[model samples]
Target: MSVRSGDKKTKILNPITIEKDFGGPIGAAFLTIFLPLTTIFLHLCCNEKYLAQGLSLEFNKVKDLFYDEVIVNFKENFFNERIWLVYCSWFFILVFLDFILPGKHLKGVELRDGTKLSYKINGLAMMGLLASTLIARFIQTNGEMPELSFIYDNILSLLCTSIFFSILLSCFVYICSYLPLMMSKNGINTNERILAAGGNSGNVIFDWFMGRELNPRILTWDIKLYCELRPGMLLWLLINISCLHKHYIETGGKLNQSLLLVNLLQGFYIVDGVLNEEGCLSMIDITTDGFGFMLAFGDLTWVPFTYSLQSRYLVLNPIQIGWLNFSLIILLNILGYYVFHSSNSQKANFRKDPASFNQMKSIKTKTGTLLLCDGWWKLSQHINYFGDWIMSWSWCLPTGFNTPLTYFYVIYFGFLLLHRQKRDEDKCRKKYGESWKEYERKVPYKIIPYIY
Candidate 1:
């Protein structure tokens, strides 16, 4: 009998099968090598002086069978460079394994399967992120302790300092990683164009990680459902604290002023991105980074270590010093929240029923004939961006400007929106042709009123 099975039989394999099978072994080897090497480096750098000082602190037991001091130590140590390195070492190794191993071919799953697929791991990028994280950690640990030199027990200065660094560090981490990905030749742009051209529209994790054994779409839905149930407001608050506040305390800490007033304002932009939903959805993963970076490293490193688990340490502690600023800060938060939430809601409502809320009219102007009228969109072509800037200012206000670093979020976001708006305009002009010309004539402004 002629064996027809060899030519006809098809094999289906999950993308993760190889990683799942080999991940543990690879991960184990990495930790075994990385941990010891890191410890040796620390030992060499710190020598007996630091070690002796570290060891001298005795653990005083308390309630919860874990002493408060011990708990504090755990929190602080979690943010330390050593712990971060150890954790990253494991993931780094897994990425390394992906690089080395021959990617398997399967009958059912292929990059051309109309689905976006990333068969190889982003080892180089991951390594760069790990390095940047290390640098941030090193600066925090080695940098001069935040001196309360400006005022004799001035609490506001301290709080401002904390907010400044926290925001700065967060921005640093974000920009270092995101800029490369966005600008890379074989990056999100390629994926976006690919998806637009009738290819598979699966989530980014599947495409970036080559883990096709699991349906990434289902996983993404599950994550969204879970996020929806809990709502990330609290998580955002928590994670933001851990990540950003460290620099504040290390450089020159202050009060627990509500940067949320600012974040609330920033939220308007964030929500706008969310409403856009296409680019924004990918942002969460990009920001949080597989929980490996955020949960394992972020919570321990930034939250407890830098800020010492007291978000309000700088803002609340020195009531007398920050009194005037605190009052102003509160007002800013309120304004930010009002503008942010109101503008977003207005946009959402307008989008829901454009005819009812907004009146469409064609107008002749100096530029040309364009669509003009009244409503949210007509109020200003991109009022949401204005609200976004206001919110960013409010958040940065709390930092009180020891350095301009804290304003990075607002500045970066503004630039991002402007670029995006320009890009969208170009696309609209190309797609809508004369309709866009007429619309531009009607609108007359890009982002702000009587300004641009």
Candidate 2:
């Protein structure tokens, strides 16, 4: 519903939450559009050329640099057939596969209305299908595959396209929620609209950013699930593979150790995500948050386009990682994935049925859910977040002592998880009251081990 600040001073992310009330409601609305657009613009601005130009500019020269690059070169990269085709094809393929594939039907947690939404789980199958399709294409072409180079060549074009799609989808979903009754035939009219826990504070900017509704559905389609797991996650892997292919071509078809290590670790991470697809249903983003601009932009644009930066960086500038470092990196990734996956599975399994893991001990509270103060949960209140931090760093380290640009995910993700952990703790406190305090006392650390 809303991100947690330091304490329980929960501010609804509306227009009034702005630092200055220059234009009032208009200011809030402007911010809702301005912030995300600026981030996207800056990301485009930080392209290889722009960054180089930035370093070479003086006070007055900066304006000239911006005019030439931002206004001139940016427009050139913003539009390309390769970018458009790849972006469109990627979206179409993922959605179509999700539609036609067979999956196991499962029920989510019961909502306040006493009904559980059913979801079809088939992400792992989809991954296999994608890999097989690519392999088939490679084989049919007699070991030659050129399509993968498109992403490397048209990174900016793809980025602009992704931003366009994100804005389009966010607006479409907002409209769907805004006029659901009118949009929904048979006049299944309702007086009150369903809003998320901390959303719908009557601030247009805040509501637009945070989203107003929880579990928005169109017939059997759950919009949140579709965005959260299906498209962008796979798209991220596809981008990495493209980077790998392009690197291979440039490096005389010989992939270096650093790039290979990054590719392998990320591939494992994605495979883990796909294999444990059901676990995602229990996460906060799925059961709690609404489908809004924040999530829409994040899932559609930021994830696929930005998250694979390390691999993208390594494509043009190949870094040689020694075998020792490669092995160490692999071990670190495995450790992180092991802890992250185990903690998530333990908690999910505990919630599904406490007896699922016989060795796993938990404290059963009065409200009925068990507090897992054993195993990974004993290490920290949010041990999985620590694991995520470890893996994010591992993903970046392969780039070596390079520009700070490659390490952006590590910095950004750390803050994200910090806020997420605090938010989850706040949610638990509200849900379980005194019992949550007891659980916190039992597991003192928030994220890291003993130190934090």
Candidate 3:
């Protein structure tokens, strides 16, 4: 990767010399093993059968990790053909929708080579079409919904299938990144296949985990962007709905308040994401990160399975929240959303057109980029992250502290956001130098207001 500085282009060499993030190669290898296992472990702990057995999420139960029955069950159900077919079909359907859907063709940020990639802004439309189809099916069935409960019933198998495919996709992209570029009649442009910064560490395990290509594309279809929102995020909503449907059926047409809230809140988040799909183009994942195992596993498997933990927990252990608590949770989410949305909007707007924020207090970086010192940006350097963390708490709060497992999302998300914030800070410190220190001094806090 190369950064354009004035008329000079600074070239970054392949195979980064020094490695630190993700604990270098050894840490990457450990995570490669640990992340998938963690996902599977969480699923096993929170599954209907395990919860029905009156087991607590205590450390003593760790011994059951290698129980004969558990191992046998996993081995038997881990590779179901039906589940694989369903998973693959859903993925392909999303791909097909991405191709045929109509929306504005927005251009992405210019690359080092001054090339702009066009992306379709049809995620919301695709979501609507899918929802309409599902609704139609429900209507056609005379008010009887399709077997969405199947998703919950076969959750383990689905997770396994997704993991398998994530690894497969990661391998495919990693190998493709190394292949020599084919020369076009117009001549070869090496910039068309740029490696991700820090992705080429000369360690296969680390590189594979971190991702090789900055933006791996097959023709015009961006694999990373497609995976970012389409399959994993939409599937998360689908899983919540499935769990909700299961609860509804098992309770004889009654819905649990906590389950309902989880569904509504998470569904809203997913809808908001789909509607604002264009915003993803500027996110760190799309602009900076490579398409590798870290992202693939997170997008394909970890998100849908682990994010729906609260709903999954409520399925077997329904927790009833009082109206007062429910209203408080809703209010909390509203506040969080306000902070998240407004802060992100301010930053995006400033990035797109700094002139619009001329009246806003700002500091210009050495690279000619302006940082706002007013509005939400004034509160904290990563005020948006604070908002996002707040919302994550609301998602888990409805679970009512029965098991620490249910609260995993909030805790894990807090750490994840902190790690991401640190990454952004490091990158900014390097890019902006003393200007970043000035921005930090002005903002004071990193994520929370009046706190560290």
Give me the candidate number with maximum TM-score: 3
Residue by residue across 1-452, what tens digits does model 3's lDDT show? 33333456555434363645799889989998899878877877876457823236455564465353346676555677788888999999889889989888898876645567778888778888979987997788754566586787788778888888999999999999987656431332544476777687677988899898888887778899899889999889989998888877777889899999999999999999988989999898988788899999999999999999888888889988998999999999999999999999989988889998898999999999888989888888899999999999899899897667788888899999999998998899999999989998898898999997
Predicted structure 3: lDDT: 0.83
Alpha-carbon runs more than 4 Å astray in model 3: 1-10, 13-17, 52-60, 65-70, 183-192
Q: Looking at model 1, which ten-residue stretch has the lowest summed lDDT?
A: 192-201
Per-residue CA lDDT of model 2 for 1-452, tens digit only, reads 22223354643321122222225456546755675554454354345654422123455655654466446766565665666677778777777777778888888876543347788888878878988989998889755576666556666667667766776776676666565333322222232234565445566566566666767776666778888876778778878888788767666779888878888988888777886788778888887776777788788777877687778667657788899999898888888887887888777777667776657666677788789888888999899898889999899899887477677789889999988887787778878988888888888899999977
Model 2 residue pairs with clashes: 13-206
lDDT of 1 by residue, 173-279 (tens): 32232222222222323221111111111333222222111222121122221222112322333323432344355436542434433334433433343233332
The prediction achieving the highest lDDT against the true structure is: 3
* Every candidate's lDDT: 0.37, 0.71, 0.83
What's the distance in Å from true for residue 407, model 3? 0.9
Show how many residue pairs clash in every candidate, following the order shown: 25, 1, 0
Better of 1 and 2 by TM-score: 2
Candidate 1 accuracy as lDDT: 0.37
Q: Rank the candidates by TM-score, best first.
A: 3, 2, 1
Superposed on all Cα atoms, model 3 deviates from the true structure by an RMSD in Å of: 2.5
